[model samples]
Target: METRSRVLFVRAGLPEPALNVEIHDPDGGWLATSDLVWREGRVVGEYQGAHHFGDYGRGDDDIARRRLIEGSGWLFVDFTKGDYYARPRRLALLRRLAGHLDCALDPAGLAAIEDSLELPGPPVRPCGA
Candidate 1:
């Protein structure tokens, strides 16, 4: 999912983010290793899978981790399966990321990427009977 996210950004003409990089504070204290990190943009992206919501209070841990990272002044963005697999959602997500990173998107590039994906097309309408 992280790799896919990276590819999505690249295909959309956005800067590719680092994968599984450790974020650190000014004092050099390790904050958390983000699934995706745009260092210059100070943005962290996380892919939340089933493990993130599994038993053993993992959800709580995720919330705390996000708080810690945000408190350290990094913009946190999380993506779930839905956000990844859906086309419209993916476009929206990319736009949101672009806004956060102050990156301009090429509409033609995004259209090409969307065309390349084997996603299901829009619903068909029945002719008037």
Candidate 2:
């Protein structure tokens, strides 16, 4: 999933983000290890799986971790399975991430990536049939 996310960002002309980076406080205390980190942009992204929100009781811990990271003056972004798979959600996520990174998005690149996904498209019909 991390690889897929990276591909999505790169294919959309967004800068490639660092993977599994450990964030720390100024005092050298460990905050969290984010799935995606843009140190220059001070942005941290997490791909939350089912365990994070399911009955496993990790949601509270995740929230606390996010707070710790945010308290240190970093923007935190999270993505769920739906956010990665659903077209609308994926586009929104990419836009949001780009905005956080203070970068412009390439609509053409994004469109090309979407086309390359090879998902089922509308049926074709003979002209004037």
Candidate 3:
């Protein structure tokens, strides 16, 4: 899922967020270990796979952890399989998120990704660069 998300960021021409990072509070308290994190932008992304469901999914502790991060002014993006599989949708969504971080996505890069998707070839985990 992290690889897939990285491809989306690449195709969208957005700066790549650090993978598997831990966000901390001002006093250096552990907040959450995120799948993707852009500390300067205060944006943290997590790919919530099906395996994360059950009592582990959004439990009381998880909610509190989220609140801690959000209270520290961090923006969190929870992505699912849909966000990873659909390249176009991912690109569009990345554009929106990038905008929230005061960044821009390159149109040509997204267009190229769309073009590649139409090619006749074996499916790649992340067809984008």
Clashing pairs in 3: none
**Could you tally the backbone clashes for each prediction?**
0, 0, 0
TM accuracy, model 3: 0.78
**Model 2 poorest ten-residue lDDT run:** 118-127
Model 3 segments beyond 4 Å from truth?
56-58, 115-129
Native-vs-model 1 lDDT? Answer: 0.81
> Taking the tens digit of each residue's C-alpha lDDT, what string does model 2 give over 1-129?
766776678767688788899999999999888899999999998988877878545888898999999999999999987777787888889899999999987777777656444322332223354
- Per-residue lDDT tens digits for candidate 1, residues 1-129, read 666667677767788788899988878999898899999999999999989878669888889889989999999999987776787888888899999999998786788656445323322223341
Clashing pairs in 2: none
lDDT tens readout by residue for model 3, 1-129: 677666667566777788889888988988889888887788888777766666754566667777888998898777777765576666566776787678877787667665444322333344454
TM-scores of all candidate predictions against the true structure = 0.84, 0.84, 0.78
Residue 86, candidate 1: alpha-carbon lDDT: 80
**True lDDT of residue 103, candidate 3:** 81
Winner of 2 and 3 under TM-score: 2
Q: Using alpha carbons, what is the TM-score of model 1?
A: 0.84
